[model samples]
Target: MTTVTLSGVGAAMPQPGDAPSSLEWLIYQSATAALVDAGLTRAELDGVVIAASDQVDGRAISSMLTSGPAGAYLNEEINVASSPAHALVTAYLQILSGTHERLLVSSWGKASETAGGSIQAAERLSVEPFYERDGGLSALAATALQASAHRAAAPDRARAEAAAAAVAARNHADGMTPADVLASPLVAWPLRALECPRETDAAFSIVVERSGRAGSEGISLDGAGWCTDSGRVAERDLVGLPHLARAAADAYERAGVRDAAAEVGDWQLHDYSPDAELLAYAPLGLCAPEEALELALAGAQPVNRGGGSLRGEAPFGGPLRKVVDAVSQLRAGAGVERAVAQIAGGFAGQFQTVLVIGRQA
Candidate 1:
């Protein structure tokens, strides 16, 4: 199988607002910039994978609207129709299958296009209509459930609060003061706005090519996996993300990774909420659940380097944004040689994607 390397990455981020540029325009800008970064022209890209969701985009068959802007006009193109991180794995498979030499992958989300209440409704709709939806499950409420579960499963609440607060404090998008984080209004019981990822208008792209022909400084998708679960939330252990844990375990096995936290130079987490990060600690092998405070409170990037997803973002673009940040960090200097990015979507991580990145081809 051919090796896949991350040859280039670019992003266009405007504060989430009623902006002037259309979503297509943002994609075009980011895609074009990525090609420039890769030192490749449109003609050199053999295929394209664009990620977006109709529900989020507020239109069906949204790819029909984005292909031209993404530079996939008259070329091979497919829509992951999910998180951009999933698009990366799909692009890697296309390369490994020897079906494409180079691919351009892009993803974006314009939260400003939809009303705040509407976005919340869309999130609630993600749950199963017959079961979970009727019980009232929004992303925020689901995360709150996970937070409560984590605390209940722990030996004591103080340790859980400390670890979770550490993730919130260190990764706050605007560097929100600790007092500000505490003062942030609660959207759901035990779930404050400060503990959640902010919505934004953003478009990001990356160029991936077969290793030997790709540039020397490029990072490669060493291993990855996507997982889904329907184990029924009511009976599930909300404190742990089993689907993500399984995905990480599968990716690690392929990458030959034994000690994930110790081996990785940097980590990029979806951290849908503060407790989500603490919940993922033991699963990702970052540290024991009880020891989360030790790493999280230590410093910036305790585990999530690039300030994680708390900084720049696109609502559904969390996973891909993580990858984009990792690429920037890897190319910047030495010391940080390997990284991982994790993204989950749905009620308490119904679907998950994990990617293991390394400097070597």
Candidate 2:
């Protein structure tokens, strides 16, 4: 098997409605910066893989307009409509096939460009028209439903609240107290305004190469696994996150990781909501679902060092940001030999992807 390394990463964070640059410009800046970080030029790239959402981009076939900016000029290009982490997975497999030696993966979300109510309309359209869509089942409602279910199963609301506060504090300079989080406006039955992530206009790019091909030492892409649950929301095991468990299991086996809690040092979780992060504990083999909050409040788990989605979520690009953060940590000698980056996509966390990264030995 060919070892794949994440050679470099770059990103552009523009406050919504504050930057005059177009979305393409953000992509170009990040892609070019990644190439520079990797000590490579566009002429040396084999291909480009992009992850984007047509609805969020406010254009049909958005990739056609965006690929060139991603350094895909005259080169092979592929697009993933799913999470940006999936683009990394695609690039990794392509390298293993020996058909491509180097690939650039890119994704972005310009939520600021979306018209009012359009983003929610896009989320509603994800469900079947006949049943779920007619019931006003948007992403927020579904996540609230899942959180409600998780609360019912665990029945430890205070601990869960504390854990969420801990995460918020870790990510934000002025962390919210559990009371503050609860006092925030209740968007859904159980989800509060503070508990949900704020949307941001952000873009990320990563340079991946077959190990030794770039002649640049980098973080090793040790393992990757992704799984999608049934599209029907009612069919999913909301509290269990079974798909996440399966994906993590697959990734762990590939990386030869038998004990994740003991072996992996950092966790970059794509937390759509505070409960969503708690739900992932058991699935990722980090801890039991019930114990997750306890461990989090106790400062035992090294999850979300980069503030996760709580800080700013860029729709499809959030997962790619997690990958970038993981690689940065490893390269900076974060005292961990290995780390895990997990991303969720689709409505109510239906799709899950896990990547295990390690420092070059």
Candidate 3:
């Protein structure tokens, strides 16, 4: 098979306390960081793929904001205002399809500038208008509802919740406490402030190269894949996701992983909402439906090792940040022999993307 390699990677967010830069400025910073990481310049870029959330950008077409800054140089350019992993999937397909070899993937979000309810405004209107938007349901409420259903299936709420909190506290950049999680105030029935993704303004960039070439650091983008599920929350089973299962299965197959729970090294699973992380456990084959807590307590696997979006609080940029973290883990020798990164979105349990990167060819 024709393989792809990630040659460079970089991330940039607005300087804290500084006047937030324009969307274009964010794009420039991300692109610049990635090019520098790859040891390439704007003069070498021939393709640009951007991922974002239109709602976060408060713009109809978020890519319109990045055109000039992305260094497309009048070459092929594409943008998907979805998850950054989704964008990476799209870019990977383009490269394998022979449209482009050198791909630049970037994502940005500035939730700080907007109303920042995160619940009422962060989801998809096209898919879950009634339950997610029309009913004024926030992501926390939806996740709480799903969590409630999940807990019913398993009966160990405190342990699972604690395990989730431990994962968050350990991997996060700031290393928040379980007490901080406990006292953060409830968002839904059982979901607390600490259990949710912290909203922040951030941007990320990555360069995936085709095989037979290497980045400045000799890193490679071996394999990656992203997948999704149905939208309507009412029609699907809320307690679990078959879609992410399919995604993980496919990504594992492509990456030549036989037993994910045994073979994988570190992981950067999306934990945007604690409920989502709990649900993801079973689907990704990381653990059984209710065994997540026991496995978590044992510390068998270091999930959300980079702290995930929960600690970073950058929603739209979370997936790319996760991918960047996965790349770092692989390059830094922090994972098993391999690592996997997963990202998901959409309302009512829909849309998921999983990427598995390994050290071997």
Candidate 4:
């Protein structure tokens, strides 16, 4: 396997007190910012890989829709059409294959265009048409089942909720209390409205290079693993995702990790819903799900130091921002030597992807 380095990272979003911008503008902003961060001109990019969603972008061919915006205009572009993490891994593989030396990875989504229940309806339609669509399986309901399962399986349900609530309070952007999180109206039995991520429109761009070939200011992109499970959420055991566990194991092995629970410096798991972070603990080798929540609330883990997705998140760009934030932290010398950016797609995390990035060889 060949290692790669993230040479640059940049993003665009609506600043506080500023009005929202077009998706195209956001993409352009990030694309240009990424080139600046890499200290390279646009002429150096050999190709581009974009992650996008047709449903979220509200278009037929999302790749074609974003070509100009993402700065891939006349260049060879490969669209992952899945999670942004998938696009990042694809770029890594291309570098490893020696077919490409430098690539720009980008992804974006604008939830503001179709507000109200339009986005929700489109998401519900993503379910298996024959098996799940008619039954109306959407993001909220799928996550609600998972939350309910976690609540039922825990030894001390109140303590678990309290721990999750404490972590939730820490993620409220500004000042927020545990009582506030607990008081929020329930979205779907057991999952309060505040526990869910606040949707936002955003875009992210990254530059990657082949091993031993990047500038001195980059972070190493060492190991990655992606896998998909049954899309039928009702069929799988909600308590544990075996395939996600295997994906984590594969990522850890590739990263030469012996004990992830104690080794990793950053845990950027895609906590899509309330307590979702707790559920991911054991699967990603952090700890028993029961203990993970407690550890997280007690300040024992680095899970979502910047509030994860709960603070503010992009609909299709969740994975993209995770990678971008990790890069920013690594660059800031924030006591992080290694970081894992994880994302999920499909039903109940039917697809899981992991990227283990570090500062060393």
Candidate 5:
């Protein structure tokens, strides 16, 4: 297996209401922060990977849209439409293949401009379009249907779910109550407004290099598994996703983790929604499906301790933030002996990515 090391990581999120700047400004801000974090000058960057939806941005290509401003003029670049996590995986493989040694991976989305529906729009394009768009199925509705079924098999612990939300919200500096979650208006059946993640604007970036002290610098990417399910919801098993289970199994084997629950003391979760995180727990083996709420609430397997995307709304930034938070937990050196940083894409019977990071051997 090819091991990839993280040399430096940096992220920039536009404040909740930063006056909109031209595309160039957005790209420059992100690139500067990232290069600085990596301890390299802009001229030192050798490669760059960009992740963003130009269609959603109402632009043609990121290169054309943010050219001189993005500092792409400073290095080589490639573009993809998936999550930043997706970009990282591709970059990791490229490095392992001896294609590139130093790389900057970034994804930026301005929810302020495109609004919050981009995730669903991007998701539908990846799957059988007829099943979702022609059927008029929104992601929330799909997740709600799944949540309803999950609750039927088990039961929704309103308090536990709320507590998990509270944990994420408070840690992120937002202090919403369990009652807030319970009373929040419904977006889709069984999925209260609070149960789903809010749409916030932000950008994310990370730097990976082939040469570095693995465990000493920061959390290294030990194992990564990403897969996509049938895009058509009707074609997928609504009850559960075997692909996720398979992905987790692959990651576990790669990381040499025999018992994830016992070995992983902390988790940085992408709980974009109660059901998504709830659905995620079992596949990752953090706990049994129904047991996730209890485990999360009791702090047994504390997830989204950085408040997740729920605490703050930064679409492209969520997973990157989760990775950074996990790295912090691993580097704290006080407690939290071990940790795993996890992120997902294509939820609701679609694409998913799972990454396990920790102190490398």
Candidate 6:
């Protein structure tokens, strides 16, 4: 097997109305920035892997419009309609197969162009039209169901909410308290507005190359795994996140990680909701589900040091951004020797993927 590493990463996360640039411009900006950071010309690239959504991009066959801006012109290109982390998984496999030496992976989301109600309607459509959709299940409602399950499983609801607030406060500039979080309007039955991620328009690009090919040492992508659970919401063990557990186990086994809590220095779990982050801790082997709230309150691990999605989340690009952040931290010698980035797709987090990256092979 050949080793693969991330050579460079770039991102464009402009707030709504903060920049006049179109989505294509943001894609081009990030792609060009990544190539520049890698010290490689676009002509040297082997191919490009893109992560995007036609519904979110507001165009049918959206990749056709995005491929050129992503430096894929006249080159092999493929798109993953799922999360951007899956795009990285595809790129990694391509490089490991020796079919490509160096590849550019890009992902973006322009939430600014879509209306909130429209997005929610799109999410509602993702449910099973036969039953779930008729029951009024949208993404927010599914997540609320999961949160309600977590709330029931929790030994102490007040303590769990406090811990959740503490996690959110870490990302807020003004800082927030448990009282503040509780006082916020409840978007879902059990989830407060502050506990949910704010959607943003953003793009991210990464340069991945086979080890020893780029003339520059980069952060190694040691292992990766992904899995999808049954689409039926009732069938899932909402509190366990079994699919995520399986994915993480596969990744850890491939990486020879026997004790993730001790060996992995940083963690970037998709925090679509604060409870979603907590739900991940046990699955990722960071802690027991019962102990997750306490672990979070204690700040015992280096989880979401970049603030996770609580700061700003780009639906398509968010997961890839976490990978970029992990690579940046490892490269900067930020006391992190290894990191794990996790992402999910589908309604109610039905799909899960995990990547273990390290400073050394």
Q: In candidate 2, what are the lDDT values of residues 69-114, reduced to their tens digit?
A: 9998899999988778889899989988899989999999887777
Tens-digit lDDT track for model 3 on 83-148? 777788888888788767787888877766675474255553553555555675555566677766
Q: What value does the lDDT take at residue 104 in candidate 3?
A: 88
- Per-candidate Cα lDDT values, in order, are 0.78, 0.84, 0.72, 0.80, 0.66, 0.84
Candidate 4: list runs displaced more than 4 Å: 213-217
Lowest summed lDDT across 10 adjacent residues in model 3 is found at 118-127
Q: Quote each prediction's TM-score.
A: 0.93, 0.96, 0.91, 0.95, 0.86, 0.96
* Candidate 5 C-alpha lDDT tens digits along 219-305: 577777777777556677755777778777877787788898888877776566665666678888887866666765665456766
Between the candidate structures 5 and 6, which one is better when assessed by TM-score?
Answer: 6
TM-score of predicted model 3?
0.91
Cα deviation in Å at residue 73, candidate 3? 3.6
> Which 10 successive residues of model 5 have the least lDDT summed?
164-173
* Total colliding residue pairs, candidate 3: 6
For model 1, the superposed segments whose C-alpha errors exceed 4 Å read: 16-19, 214-217
Q: Which ranges of candidate 6 are over 4 A from the true structure?
A: none
Q: How well is each residue in 240-306 modelled by candidate 6, as lDDT tens digits?
A: 9999999999899988899999999989887777788888999999987778998888866788776
| Model 6 worst lDDT run, 10 consecutive residues | 169-178
Query: Relative to the unseen true structure, what is the C-alpha lDDT of residue 24 in candidate 4, on a scale of 0 to 100?
Result: 86
Off by over 4 Å in 2: 16-18
User: Which of 5 and 6 is the better model by lDDT?
Assistant: 6
**Cα deviation of 343, candidate 1, in Å:** 1.5
RMSD for each model, in Å, please? 2.1, 1.5, 2.4, 1.7, 3.2, 1.6
